[model samples]
Target: MIYTELYITEEPSEAMNYHHEVRQVQSASKKKILHETPIRSQDIFKTLPDQQRPIRVVLTYGVAGVGKTFLVQKFTLDWAEGLENQDISAVILLSFRELNLVRNQQYSLLELLIFFHPTLHRVTAEKLIVCKLLFILDGLDESRFLLDFTNSKLVSDVTQKSTISELLSNLIEGNLLPSALIWITSRPAAVHQIAPTCLDRMTEVRGFTDAQKEEYFRRRFRNKELSSRIISHLKTSRSLYIMCGIPVYCWITATVLEHMLTTEESAELPKTLTDMYSHFLLVQTKKKQKYHEGQEMRRIELTRTDREVLLKLGRLAFEHLQKKNILFYQEDLEQCGLDVTEASVYSGVCTEIFKRESVIFQKPVYCFVHLSIQEFLAAIYMFHCYTNRKTEVLQEFFTEDDKGNKISLEDISSLEDFLSRAVEEYLLIPNSHLELFVRFLNGLSMKSNQRLLGGLLGQTESSPEIIQRVINKLKVISCQGKCPDRCINILHCLLENNDLSVLQEMQDFLKSDNKSETELSGIQCSALAYILQMSEEVLDELDLAKYKTSEDGRWRLVPAIVNFRKARLHDVFVFGGSIGSLAIALTANPSHLTELHLSSVSLGEYAEDLFTHLGHPNCRLETLRSVN
Candidate 1:
């Protein structure tokens, strides 16, 4: 067993910490990911410096591609090599994706362990009781079983036979393996499957810190100058830098940048997220054709077969993305007109790229190398639908028919409205889940990106007037007070369109003498919040009322309060759904806030949690003034 360490942090067990660590469903901005506390991987099972209880049944979660599985692998390998956690006699690692295969089968806890780990076949139930076992169940989000923690039949004995869910429930709840240490890994959305009372500690894997992000690029390229240029260019685009916190995004960026710079195509380097992913797709395809097929590469071109094959994969990406299902089956591939065996050809971007992007597990389960790559491909397919006018597909997506046929975007008003409805139309949809997809969809509208994917997208209209209309529609939606997830994504959409006018306008308003005369829009408030959160210079004061803006604008600025020393939110109120961002601000580590004035403001249902922050470990508020 070989192992290597990664620079990472284990967030505090408090729900507030998890809330801030994973601010939205996708992830908090890169600024917040860097603000967390760093804890080594081996120390995850040990109690924190501030804690008293022995850590057991740890629920560690992070967003997709944040490297939760990699950390688990490293921890297990280190244990096997006798370098860490010597007290534990054995480690049993299982993935929920593998567990999904046997979801319908019944087995005793002992049999389950033996099935996954054949060496455990000789171990009896009595032996299990004596061994210090650490059961690491990975990828709870990918599990297909209904994890009913409340009513599942509890089995105290490891030999007792039961359904997989029941056995899992009892083991996780400490009924079956009371002496065993349980470690469950999941995406943040699925952590709710285990109630708060069922776990001892909750730690979030908050991706790479700033230094590690730089370390990744430097390690990738032998040339120091190339690495420096890559880092410098990433810093120029806030969106790219923020996304680079994820290791997978960093790799994708490196792949795109290395090829462009080395090929003397530095002038054609990608700046936006859409541009990067598009070039990534084409570049990977070009490499596979040249190296794997023994073809001479002279020009970057998407042949008709290449277009058909990539779109099939893209369609698969889009359909499954709607369900938030990362793993797929053979049937899923065939349904999209994709040939299973033929998919291995274009292994660079997907299907078989180093067997990383399109992964086939021990079973028939398949998935993209990363969630964002799946999203990028999905966006391409959806954009193809728009360009080709696939009404039947769009109709299926716009409404739910009894037939269960899913579709794509409809009406195709301004792409923002179309994209806006993509998030809001499905009321049951979690807005954050669709953010990356929508961002990619909007990014595809860029002229530069369109040129790159022109073959697939087929030369869509890219006029400045068309872009302004989309930008204006986004502002109207932001002002109408959409959910913070959707609103922030709207601002991201503007950034994807290269619409920096609002950001510049906010900067001008901030520097103006008669600021009271200048009124900021909701989108501008969002831009302001983003700037303040990412700024190196902390503001001495953040008084929302002083800014001339609508109620939605005020709501958008609440997230930036953590970046200021004194916050005056007098007569202000946070919307119910948006209040979580405020909670995050108050509890952010290295807190700058010393005084918070909420005079005449009402937190209402959230008042209890907000007030409880006064004693939280990260809360540094010294003065709090509020009426009613």
Candidate 2:
């Protein structure tokens, strides 16, 4: 496996390399860890303190897809290669997901060792235990075994017969092998399965830092220039860059970029999570086509079959995601119109699109490669049903199955009504996954995306009228809510449509609502910035004091606000928000503002920073006031 020291914590500025300014910003935000010493993956057990009750067990926790498994693999490989942790004679890797299948089977530790490691059959359980051993247990959250320590009898000897869970419990609790080393990996949600005293040290896999993200990309692409370009493009979207913190997402992103850059020049790069994953899905589908003969026939046949598989997979993803399941049994596959054999095929074609693996007794369990993929598939599934005019699918998306199945949009007289109902019925719930669903819905509404989908899923009407209605609905939603971020995202999706109607509508909405104050979310600010940049007319004055915003919102508005010919605030009251935009405007070359007025405003702790910029040499402020 390709390896890099792509994970680190910033202790001193001297210890890292990236960009100086980036390092400074990173160092300032992170607190100093004074007590915890840095431990390498291979040396994790070796560094544990030797005490009366030694720290023989290590618990490593992280969010899903944060490279915990990868780290384990790397560590294990290093040991096997005699590169690190050489003192440990052998390492046994076990997956809880696989372990679940053997929960019903009674086995002694000796028998279990033979099951997972057949080569070790010659060694007796007692001898294997006494030898230098490192046991790695992966994915505690996926395990179905009832690990009830309170009721289970504990045995220190290897010949003791017990259920799979009891075997694991005994191993971790030191009843089976007190001198042996154990490393367990789990998502944060499943960390409580082991008692606090059972493990010695608990470390979290923090994924990648900014510098590490850069390092990974650099290592991933041999073409340094192309890597730089990709990194630059990724940085343009904060949310997209944030997703790259996960190693799997980073790989997915790299996959998308490599496909787009090398394969097609005209193709647009992904800017959002939905777009990125959708592109990834397309890439995965196309990848299968490359191996087959008869390019045209293969493409069509594979595309058609892939679409069918994806639809069923999407339904499965949505249903399981709703149930908060990242892992599912073979029975779950049958429920979603997929048998184990068919799922195995998809697992190969998708290649981490949907994973199929066997558990403890060789019982198959399946899961989407990652949670985000599940969300993406779910979104795609919902849209599939919506486009197909399946009313029950709408109910499924909303998780309101009991509300009846006869529901249809036919009675919703207008497009606006249908959109409003869709938003209210589903998007308003604020499920984290729903955000991606709405984004995909909005993106799939685009004619270009629809064309792309059409190629793979057969033709469907790509209606500009429907797209406009959604844009209009989003604008309405943005102005009506306390946090208008999702609504803003919907509008952002339509930005490439080259339609300024949404922006004009937003401007009109802001201007017309002079009677009351309205706040724009961070995304709303981005939308406003986008509109301002796109607008041809150079206004003499612009004001946003009536609309309260946050630091992120203001920061996004900086470039747009600074370009205005004259910015004004006669009686507008700024809330506890950063005025960084205004400050940046003040410091710009030619500094467009001719006059400024602040009657009553609180610019938070960064108020002085804003004021200091006003005194800059390039400041064009003809008049200024800070009224008490």
Candidate 3:
């Protein structure tokens, strides 16, 4: 029996941050239905390897940035050090992202092994297969070629030539080296490509537990005091804290906060995903200065080269994201005006932000370190394009309408024309990449952000007049339309601009008779949370009694509700919707609503908890009304 200790980077108990609920399917439940279950990532391999029918093929799935690769890396490192899985003589690790190169190339199992693990080239196939081997295949979703099992010609010989898919299918199906073990990692989307029958055991990476998040912060920052402060600040915003579940987001946070904390640049830290990502980009840009001691020299030479590379990468990122392509080949770089030499230089200089990976038997591919970063860069590209050419870029890049026709010249003159087009054409759809891109566009307008971009591009191109026009258009559109997330992004953009007029516009929109009975979507709730954070006056209390709100919608409002200083509801609306969110929001933040008016409202079963929160000493509620 072989076992791998999680190490946890600290004492086991110390890593336990209360009881964190992991959302996954129970191992005992044969059906694939995911539910919240309390399970530790460390305890995954605790059970012994069964002698009779050992679980040889394990499939672990997770969302991007949830630490799947990190877990695999840790496991491999531990095994190599002889601390765990000693029964396995060798661990052959391969990334499908890299394996994509050899998809068409014929190779025997022995050749494929040696191709990735060149040290085994001299070892005879018979001797290698006889020894215990564990194959860890990572990033199955990154495979360029479809793993078409139905069409693949399967072969069992270790030295026989076959398609990569055929070899992989045969290996997993026990057609070749039946005794060998396999471990596969994939994002959730690609998990179904492998037949259910092939998986001996399935596990999902749930990212950092609360305790693990704390432990990570402690390990990341040398100053314990700063780490504690960062943690405390992050905990205050539910959305920010939730994002920390992704290890990469946590790293981004640490990177941004660490720099901000040390520089004394600004007291306010990024609270939203857009702000955080914008800060990340700025941090990367500033990093080049360290190489040059004189600030003047760094400023001049840095921007010229950095700007060119960024523009090219941003173009590539934007185009790829539009096509839902995260991975790219050499031609993609050239298409974006980057040659191999320039791209390589950029990759080395921006290693923290960009990555270049060699695909065996194929040309190397390039991509931003994270998908979110690509989206951010894409957004930046859109903004830069807009700044340089105004309506021309939108006409060329966004619309397919003929240039001679000139459909709406008057509409194109408005500074926010790009925002309008993005919302109407893209962001209204579910899971739109433009959602984040638009937010990045907003964040880029900030003066401090402008300074960073100005340093890069020689000068920031946007003006306050243009930003004000965009905000005005956003407010008008958000009020008239049904897309809450778009409305929120508009608000987020306004916030980045630091314009208070949008707050009044929002207040006006909420107060409008026509807009009074609108239900807030989850995205709208998030948007409201951003708005409420910066507001001195609460947006006229939402009277959603006439609105159609689902249970999920109420939960979405929790983040927004917790930001309220005083809320006056006209009916038992929130309770009738989702009592859980109401209770959680109020309990989470005692001073949330100091003067809550539930006029003609019925408490029903939620009365006890609602009253309990109101009675808490920290609560500042001085007025409570229920006039039926």
Report the number of the highest-TM-score candidate: 1
Better candidate by TM-score, 1 or 3: 1
Candidate 3: residue 419 Cα off by (Å) = 1.4
Tens-place lDDT per residue, model 1, 574-619, is: 5442235566566655567888888667676777777776665667
lDDT of each: 0.71, 0.62, 0.61
Model 2 C-alpha lDDT per residue in residues 1-628, reported as the tens digit of each score = 4332222221111111111121122222232333345566766665444445455888886666777888899998888888888878788988877776676888998888888888888988658766989889998877776577788787788988888988888888888887789988876556767787676677756667778889889999999988998999999875577666677878899998987887765667877665676677767767665543523211223445666777788889878766667788878878888766764445545675877776555676778877778877776676677666666666555443123344445643343444445554443443333444455555655566555554433345557776676666555443222222223444544553334565665577556745236666655665776556435454566555545676545544443554576654434223212223465456533346677666554555657666666556556677776775
Q: State how far residue 27 of model 1 sits from its true place (Å).
A: 7.9
Query: Candidate 2: TM-score?
Result: 0.66
Ranking by TM-score: 1, 3, 2
Q: Flag regions of model 3 displaced more than 4 Å.
A: 1-53, 122-131, 265-267, 290-302, 342-344, 347-349, 357-365, 390-397, 400-412, 428-431, 455-469, 475-628
TM-score of each: 0.86, 0.66, 0.67
Give the best candidate by lDDT.
1
